[model samples]
Target: METPSSDASAPSPWADAERIVLGRDARGGAVAVALDRGGEHGRRPLSSTELPVWVSAREAEGAATGRGIRWVWSSTAAWYSALLGAGVRVSRAHDLRLCHAVLRDAVPSASALREATAWDGAPAEAGPSAGALFELDDLSGNGAAGSRRPGRDGVAETVAELLRQDAAVAQAAHPGRMRLLLAAESAGALAAAEMRAAGVPWDAEHHDRILRDALGDRRAGGAPARMTRLAAEVREALGDPALSIDSPPRLLRALQRAGIRVESTSKWELGEIEHPAIAPLLEYKRLARLLTANGWAWLDEWVRDGRFRPVYIPGGVVTGRWASSGGGALQLPRQLRGALRADPGWRIVAADVAQLEPRVLAAMARDERMAEAARGRDLYEGIVAAGAVRTRAEAKIAVLGAMYGATTGDSGRLVPRLRRVFPDAMALVDAAARTGEEGGVVTTWLGRTSPPPDDAWRAAQARASRSGASPADETRALRIGRDRGRFTRNYVVQGTAAEWALAWLADVRLRLTRLAPVDSGEGAPRSGPAFARRAHLAFFLHDEVIVHAPAEHADAAAEALREAAEAAGRLLFGAFPIDFPLDLRISDSAAKD
Candidate 1:
């Protein structure tokens, strides 16, 4: 197996595996499969002293070529026992191949990889192989091999199947590369959208150059006239040729002229410019801007291709959460999704979680009534139905407050009633509040901790903790009181929500991997560009995700979005106490929300 050009110099982690296998068919094509552990199987180090190696073979001789190979990682569940049956060093190789297959089979859209640290303070695992350590079967497929057909809901089945095949191809070409490209494109797209939304002219070459530069690939001479012409042509075909550029200062001026305000913030060295879109354009540009400015281009370079591939950031967020990179996988910008157009003959069937936070709260609290209320209609309405409040408006306020710790008028007034109705949910909030009041820091679901109080704040807290008869004590008390209050309110809802998100992502990844490929009817391009399997849960925000789907699948990629969210719920909770829902959308026109 040839190491990718990018990984040639890096240490291979799969070297020590007992056996390695690549699943290929008679025609030498990849067959995606759903896997299940069925029973306790085995575990091993993600990689060995030798570099992780994977061989892609055609059918017939390929499967047997590397006999005595101790491990094999394929998308198909049939291989589970077959590899064991191979008698060679046939253990399942833990890496992007397996993880991607798992993710693809598990869900259509989003996937997650949990983080576990090794003793040396370095990621115990290398990349995908290092992160992929769990073994599970395909839950969506028929229990046995050669037993899957499009379900009654042909739409979903078709989409799932398409994803499976695409994923298999992606894994073979390069696990998790297509997605990286998409993530990068997504950033560019997002930036383009934001500029357009703010009425700023955008330049494609300039933007591409910006991205190239962002990745430390700045060209000495300016972009070529041919490149500029090509970009303009692309813009014209898309019906927006004159709007591309590379100057941030010029963009700022345009935005100012357009009556939009730009505010900049940074994490590490990444700069974030936030501004409100004109009411009509809000949805369209939100996501585009987010990706462009927030490391999307760099993510593309890191992963491969220009897709928004998912990067597995285990514990990326404080609360045991995972974040994605390229595709705005985490922070999906709802407005611009309509621009997520697909390739020829393909269409996106997008969906998303409805009231994800509330439902998670219901499950965490084990509040049966709340769960029942949430069973059917809008969650806010369900809150009303459960007597959590008198009306829809009140329910909305209460629920939002509960999750966000909003202590303003309506949110503050409704908190008490919410507490009274859902004790379990309230308990989390109460605990968080107490912690906050004491100046404790809160974390997200994945255990990514927030920075604690700085020296001055800590000192103030210390002073406030004592009996404050003096003026300084009084000042400290007030400061601590305000700080603690804010922390406590956000702690519980955010943390628990993050947990639900991680579980959701993990579940979706697993289930979609179990499904088979779509028939694609007749004459559909069997393969082309697609996202690499199990790349990484890179970038994330509240409820949205941007997966770097493979270019092969790019033409028909929107299906992944829908599949991921559905898988997320099923894998996390199944059809149970509550439902975790989502709204999935797609777009191709970057600036059109």
Candidate 2:
């Protein structure tokens, strides 16, 4: 309950603090609590109007004195967006909302904190207002009185949570890896916000042109000219002139009546059938997707002032990959890549890692043979050179099968060859699969533990073990168990790859900030105030990134992206001979040649 003395001349214990905790006070104002490696030392309060200036001064002072200040806040989306709006950027932050989710589920040593589910809530979306500093929604219905807890928004609760997290990390089975996971996860939150603020460069005219070229001219309230023609062709091919091609039920019934005898109306099923309507129906479906997903309506809604601003959710997926709530950032079709155009005086540096998951698997298992195979070339090609499979196509299928627990088809037939050639890597995934089948949890390379089986799964397993159990019960249990086994087999590799991507993004963001900003006259002002004059990240998928840089600084930005990737590799797997080469390009648009 003690507060910092208001006396102006009082010597402050937080003069050179290493970590600072920030939260809102009872009156909805900013509160700063300073801490060292020992513990909290002092606390101060600032008004809403003074918060920006205070942060700016602290950042300047920290930079001048060679002190790296890591800001601890409730949520990056809530706090950092406002700071960026006011032209203040922090190098590092500890997002309690994101970290709470990770620690509650993954860290066994943090059982005590897990019981307090007040911090378990979906991430706050970016909006005009900062809203509550700590909006503990208690979505799980476990908080006190089943009501909101405003006290958690204060500095005291923030400090308590931080202490609990630190203790959890220290007591974890692998403290070093747990710490790295938390840091990378937190950094990912920052990058997500920055990407949203600096939206991807889009050319509305070019987008419209692409749409027209594919779908023909746009109409006012109906399908485009080409889509209409395709729909007509599909109807005629089915011999039902008035049948609605858009409705699945109607289409399926029509196909059945037309002697197609298909069970479903899916494109894949339709493709397999030998019928006259197949090709036209497939083309109609493709054009319909483009029209509905990214048509003129989409252009009017999502893109604005030459930027597509999507809402990115960091740590959204259970495997630690990002998910977008709107704008379909992750699912940007290759057909639309050309619309990702840079500004007049800027260039886009697009880079994506090749075969990220398998390389991670090689480094994690320390399979020297697999690493040797992956030396300086495509992993699938390396597998072929090592005589594991006859062709690159077969090698790809076999490696994917091994990681995903595929047990049938050409993938299944080819997997044994890889198993013989790379026994260590095969053993790693095989063990993970076995653990999952036995209702056990597994952890990724950086300590992200998989969720425990639910009550239903446990009940099924128990039923299968009981005396006089029916064959149906045993079969069901075995099927579900294998399904979960496949999931856990892939989880470790995918989650670790996500961690690597986060590390790469964080390092690249830091390096880009160090590059000199373009002058006002030469800057791409349409990129918003925070990133208009500097090299900034524009988009990020799981293993790929696009940096929008001024034309003069394009080379520097490209080098930074490469260096960050190498740094991430070293940070994750020290001295491991695994390499992650990027297919990098610096061009005016994101389209590949």
Candidate 3:
């Protein structure tokens, strides 16, 4: 923070800085203030050009490596994207927007920090580059990118909110745990932005080939060849050549006319009925979904210059799971994984933790029995070996039943046996379900609380308990309660699993940053200069990560994934005996050798 100035004896403000808050100054330009361990440093003008250079120098000097200057921003989604585009990678950040949402519900002490601020809303998308836009044209006041990004807080407001959040964390019941959750959530925001900038290494050609193989040729303004044939077959079987097979109501009526006697055209329901139309109808739905979701048009829109830049919305889900606004990053089908091809001299190190939620559940419940069952192997198989179930299939159903609050059929039958064996784990979810049934709240392992029952739900319960309530009213109330119970039963586990995933992602990001950058041409230039030559995380689903790296660094990246998983486990659930085993491999493409 110090320039070549009068006092030669003094040390630089950023030498041992705690954090840096980025916000708009009164002059409508960007300002950065360094927070020293002692107190706040004075505000200084930071332009789009100088900010990255100073940050790059700090990184080069290795000052921000450990417990370093965490960049405090109004919204990471609005800010970090441009930073990545500018080739400046920030090591750590405190995303006020994301943290505000987490605290407003989870930490009761932090409720005053709520008060419906702009930070509570969905984050603004990353706008045009500041260096290119604002630096060239002073259209908006702030010199930073996304100066016109709606709902952004200015310098004074940003610092005030940060202080409020810090105080909220300080007053929380478990301050350390609250702080860890905030850090993890913020790290997730940063990673999401960076991943968008980096994008998934994609091969447009392979994507096209896969599309053609499954959907046939890309017919202009019409259904693909395969889809057309299937639609015709479906129409012929229904004895209605003009039937709109895509229209569910019309298709249902047509099936009824053909004497199928089915309530719905769902594959599951239709598969139960033996009919000529069933086979072709099911095939049509499958291909149509694929074609609509990831067909030729998808390739044209998403894939660009060997990368598929999906817009990632971190913390988008109520359970804290990430949702994709664009390229379906969370739902990339296994069929198109072959399109995830690395560059010529680089490779893909893909690793997904096996049964992450169950493992997290065991740790949360501290269920030694379940932990022992999962020691160094598949939990379902371990259940069978432990004599709790006859087969892995039974174990899976029972475990899923426990988490999802299943109450009938095979799941209901098998759940009791699991409850008897792993009482602690089952009890944890069962209590959460009961809380949900009574309109109470349940919290994740790291303290993310489930949202309370809505007013409609509360009204239904109240009505059902009233003196004038009838059997139908009570039945409706009970059904809704059960639905909520099911939701909360899964929420605690899913949310905590998300927390674990965030920790994993943050750790992997840091580890990847520390690795040696390779000497190569601009292989994935869209990844930005900061990451173009180094091993970088290219894709992330909830429990899986794919790191694109140099061939020589593939082993190192794989090792980082393993180490990061273990580190994340300990970071969240210290001294827990649970382990996160990964089904990992290194390859040129997502295709099998």
Specify the highest-lDDT model's number: 2
Q: What is the C-alpha lDDT profile of model 3 across 257-326, one tens digit per residue?
A: 9998989888889889888889989999999989888888888898888889899888889999999899
Q: lDDT tens digits, residues 170-250, model 1? A: 543333433322222222222222111112111233345444442334334544333444444433433433544344455
Give every collision pair in model 3.
none
* Model 2 spans > 4 angstroms off: 1-15, 127-129, 133-152
The alpha-carbon root-mean-square deviation between model 1 and the true structure, to one decimal in Å, is 16.8
Candidate number of the best TM-score: 2
Distance (Å) between predicted and true CA of 561, model 3?
0.5
Each candidate's clash count: 151, 0, 0
- lDDT, candidate 2, 1-593, per-residue tens: 23544343344555578888887665556788888887767678876556666777777667877987889987888878877777677888898889888887777667766765667877566531445645445422244422456543656666777877887787777889988888899998888888888889999999999999999998998889998888888889889999999999999999999999889989878889888788888998998998889888899999999999999999888899999999999998898999999999899999999999999999989999999988899999999999999999999999999999999999889999989999999989999998998999998888888988878789889999999999999998998899889989999999999999999999999999999988856587777778989999999999999999999999999999999999999999999988888888999999976
- lDDT, residue 49, model 1: 20
lDDT of 2: 0.85
In model 2, where is the ten-residue run with the lowest total lDDT?
138-147
Regions of model 3 farther than 4 Å from truth: 1-11, 61-67, 127-152, 520-522
